[model samples]
Target: MAKLYSKKKLAEAPKMLPKQETIDFILNYSKALKVVKTSNGTYENIAN
Candidate 1:
């Protein structure tokens, strides 16, 4: 019989949040973008 799982300890990872500038930039830029999916398997940008 073989071992089912590893007995090694996992390391602790730190979580970081996005900067204020990055969040604001994305919010502004994303507002002008529009995406639409057609009958085919391709994505189309319908923003005008």
Candidate 2:
């Protein structure tokens, strides 16, 4: 599936569309991605 979140699109989007679920999903996905990166050691979790 095409991503519901896109960095480029988000950068240009107006600041209104993110309802609670969208925000929650982004937060959860980011956390999970960080854990995956840490476990694989292929990418650094620079946000920390």
Candidate 3:
């Protein structure tokens, strides 16, 4: 079902953006992690 939102309601909605700390954590974690591609052409995460 399609629900329409009023302009005022949309404007009042809070900005749904990730916090700086969250982004930093994700970036640091990804940097420390390792990844590789398999024969099927798909990525795999091997953090250990």
Best by TM-score: 1
TM-score of each: 0.47, 0.38, 0.44
Per-model root-mean-square deviation over C-alphas: 4.2, 13.2, 4.2
Any idea what lDDT model 1 has?
0.72
Cα lDDT of model 2 overall? Answer: 0.64
Please write out the lDDT profile of model 3 over residues 1-48, one tens digit for every residue. Answer: 234553345356678999999999888888877666788886756463
Supply every candidate's count of residue pairs whose N, Cα or C atoms clash at under 3 angstroms.
0, 0, 0
lDDT of every model, 2 decimals: 0.72, 0.64, 0.73
Q: Model 1: number of clashes?
A: 0
Give the clashing pairs for model 1: none
Decreasing lDDT order of the candidates: 3, 1, 2
lDDT of 1 by residue, 8-35 (tens): 5577678889999999988877786777
lDDT of 2 by residue, 1-48 (tens): 356555355356567777899999888877766433455576645354
Cα error, residue 30 of model 2, in Å, equals 0.3
